[model samples]
Target: MAACIVEPILSSGGVIDPPAGYFAALKRKCEERGMLLIVDEAQTGLCRTGSWYAFERDGIVPDILTLSKTLGAGLPLAAVITTAEIEQAAHDRGYLFFTTHVSDPLVAAVGVTVLDVLQRDGLDTRAAQAGSALRAGLLELQERHECVGDVRGRGLMQGIELVTDRATKQGADRLGSAVTARCFELGLHMNVVQLPGMGGIFRIAPPLTASDEEIRTGLDILDTAIAECVSAAV
Candidate 1:
């Protein structure tokens, strides 16, 4: 392949963080073939994955990096970053692409402010701390609830895969929606994904500004919802 594009952490498909050394090896393979390694950190960027960028966890750099979602801190803003060599090459080739949305000063200012706040507040560190606490809570849930087959992710972005049986890893596609609705009813909003082969996975991506109390409350709600659904099924 000339280039390979991948999500640093597969957020849409599932909150699946790649195994250790996966990206480093992938980068080598791309480099050997003289291919650009494009990383889509759109969902995992701006301290969402407990780091400034998800790729940083892999200890490698992407040739073309894409950022979004958190880039504007809730505003509609996105950006693509590349090395100077590529930018100079593109400029030399007279690559002209323009969009009104991309040039908006208001959005640009918002992006700057978002960066400033993230750095000044040490949100990356906050995300790490919060993620550890969240993961521990979810792990306890997995032990208590057989439906949560797996709990995996990094930083503030985490997930729990619903299953009917732990040994079989049977997907419980509808369970996510049930839990989601219940959690919402209890005052906690959550997102769930039902994908081919993967079944249902609930994503827990709380705001970086959320306090420890808020995080614990969300987890408590989630726990109650899942337990409620499983018991109802029984």
Candidate 2:
């Protein structure tokens, strides 16, 4: 097998965070099969998960690492990192990799600046602190709302699954759409998972630079939207 590529936290997959030591166990399985373990940190890297990378919490280093999204800070740039032995092997095999717009100095500079700011401003720690407040707010909402079936995630990346009935855990797909539309109308754009069987999952990822007041304001907007939508349903 070439490699097993995975997103440390399933962002579009309902923002699911794997259980503790999950990656460690997966890595062991990969080793047994003589396959390379590749971690894709496009959405969870650069302090998005309260750390430089979500895989750090797993305590296992991947054989290959891929990064993008936050790395360019909106620009189109990506990176692949691997150990010297693997890199040498690939080079010896004459393997070539390049994107349509490769070697752009402007984007490269932006990526460097992003790294500098993430480190200089201690955004990793900021993400952790902000995530704590965000999760607390989400939990409070879960307690107050019967439709909030589940709240799960880590750091600034979180998700809340809406259900018609919490006891059944059935996805409230239509209600999810309504709440998102209401949130947009209220000037707070919300993202809901579009996949079948996961349509009720709402992905809530606030910017790491957001202030405490901003986070609270967003939560308030979300609360108002959910309440309005649920009331309209009845």
Candidate 3:
């Protein structure tokens, strides 16, 4: 009741990045109301935003943070970070989520190893550089595709919005599905999040280890997918 939670970058919801100081203002308002600020980095954490945490760019720290998605390095691992004050309060109140293997030692060890690799190999910087190439390529795609309503995301995570009408910025759900299928057929598997009638949002999150060539190849496939889809529609 006294907490506000949000995804740093809207992923499945739309991959929308809020305006600058969005989170900082949100945290400020939450503090004013004596509420906790919780950031769900399920999609934008661990160098996805060209930073260790997306919130870093906003210059705000959440009282609680939730992480998942790529946290386990292809393993099913999630982590929650919170201020000691809130954590201690929960402990004092004996509040806990029921779980048996919630923090299995093996999985925890794996998480540690994953963190080590991420830090040791400098995958964060890798994501930044790789993301730059991918993002630039996506922007180029938008120039050629009338259906590309918007291009967004940061670091290794990027999204392209498809719209049937650029003036109204309407979503092109049907065309988006077609492009996805076409891309798959062309040997580049991808996903386009369909939010009912709103349209489809293509999420492009290449692995950090991906080479520059691979990123360019993916963008080329995506560009081809859009071209083919547009031609078919016409």
Highest lDDT, which number?
2
How well does each candidate superpose onto the true structure, as a TM-score? Answer: 0.96, 0.97, 0.96
Candidates ranked by lDDT, best first?
A: 2, 1, 3
* lDDT against the true structure, each candidate: 0.90, 0.93, 0.87
Determine the C-alpha RMSD for candidate 1 after optimal superposition of all C-alphas: 1.3
Q: Could you tell which candidate, 1 or 3, scores higher by lDDT?
A: 1
Task: Assess the local accuracy of residue 229 in candidate 2 as a C-alpha lDDT between 0 and 100.
Answer: 96
Off by over 4 Å in 3: none
TM-score of 1: 0.96
lDDT of 2 by residue, 22-135 (tens): 999999999999999999998898999899989999899999998998889888889888999999999999999887778789998999999999999999999999999999
Candidate 2 lDDT score at position 113:
98
The parts of candidate 2 lying over 4 Å away from their true place are: none
Identify the superior model by lDDT, candidate 1 or candidate 2.
2
Tens digit per residue, CA lDDT, model 3, 83-174:
89899999999997957779888888888887788899888898988888898998898888888989999898898899988999888888
- Lowest-sum lDDT 10-residue window in model 2: 97-106
